[model samples]
Target: MIRVLIVEDEPLIAEAHRTYVQRVTGFVPVGIAHSGRAAMRAVADAAAYGTPIDLVLMDLGLPDTSGLEVAAALTGVTPSPDVIAITSARDVAMVRTAVAHGVVLYLLKPFTFAAFRDKLDHYREFRASLPSNNDTTVSQHEIDRALSALRTTDLRASTPKGVAPQTLDEISRAVRAAPEGVTAADTATNVGVSRITAWRYLEKLAEDGLVTRRSDYGRAGRPKTRYLWKTKHAN
Candidate 1:
């Protein structure tokens, strides 16, 4: 599981964020800290327990300390937690500093559930592409795919002409909602699109490492293509 530590001052908002993390596949909400000091302690405690946090959902404005300072402190720790700033901070200079400290994703406040899910899903793909155990030599394609998965947010940007983003998002949600996976035809039926159109979106997701594609040969003239949602810690 991708263990997450949510750092938000507001109790209601923090609870909502925790719930959101739980709803997503491959992610587990391990703890919530209401301030920067508590967040630091949580990270240390997790490390001491031998199950360090994978990500920190941090808020920029905290009563005690700035989130950026916490992020900078985390950078000095061994096996530091990856940060995704979930705040309303819109200052360009602060954003640049956050990037310098290795914040992987920046999510502005007042985002919808769909937007939040997209960021987490993207992170999952990027994490799955990396070597889980150790540092090792990797091919250029592997490196490129990993980086692209981390940076790419708009699926429409990479789709070939004629594929609509709205339809692609619908197809993605359908596949993700099915734990047992979905076939192209089934996705088409669910999303009210043609099988060919659904297949195109599925193929794109599979290529992007967001979903796993396999062949089902039982009771088939030609083997059927099956796609499943990639689960926790799958590499």
Candidate 2:
């Protein structure tokens, strides 16, 4: 499993991020740190326990110091964790600095669960493509695919002729809000669209790798194909 440490000053936002991390498959929240100092301490404590943290969701603004400085400090750690900036800071210069400091992903604030999950999913794919054993040299094709996984593919560009982006967003929101997951009929009712229209949006999301479709066998007759948000890490 991928152990994650959340470094955010805001308590509520940190809690929300913790929840988001739990929803993904292959990842688990190791601990939360409200400041840079606390983050370093948490990292040490995790290492002491023998399970070092694998990833860090770092907010650029911290009460003690800037997240960039924290990232620099982590460079000297014995088992350093990969950092992903999760902050509202959109300054290009700050982003460039973060990239220089070894941040793998930069996620903007006020994002939906779908967007958040997409980032982590991409990260997972990138990590999965790495050499399972260090001795094996990475082939050029493997290297290219791993790097490509980190880049977000624009799902909007692939939208079919008739589906409106607004409708798709609405359908995505409805499904994401449903923790137990939602079917096309449920999405249709929530978004006030026809079942077929809702299914079209759900299918689009699934095709874009933002959602999952499964067979619901609970009901007696004709097992309905249920469309659910794919927020969890896949096995």
Please report, in order, the local distance difference test score of every candidate based on alpha carbons. Answer: 0.86, 0.84
Query: How do the residues 1-235 of candidate 1 rate in per-residue lDDT, one tens digit apiece?
Result: 9999999999999999999999998999999999999999999889888999999999989889999889889876666899999888889998999898788889988987777888998899888888886467888978877877766446656777877777877788898778788999999999999999889889988887778988888884898889996643123
**TM-score, per-candidate, Cα-based:** 0.73, 0.71
RMSD of each: 5.4, 6.4
Candidate 1 wrong stretches, greater than 4 Å: 135-141, 155-168, 175-184, 188-235
Clashes of each: 0, 2
Candidate 2 lDDT over 1-235, as tens digits, reads 8999999999999999999999987899989999999999998888778888889999989999999999988878867888999988888998899999999899999887767877887788788888756478988988887877788654556778998866876787687677678888888899999999998889888877778888989757988877776543232
lDDT of candidate 1 at residue 27, scale 0 to 100 = 99
On a 0 to 1 TM-score scale, where does candidate 2 land against the true structure? 0.71
Which candidate achieves the best lDDT against the true structure?
A: 1
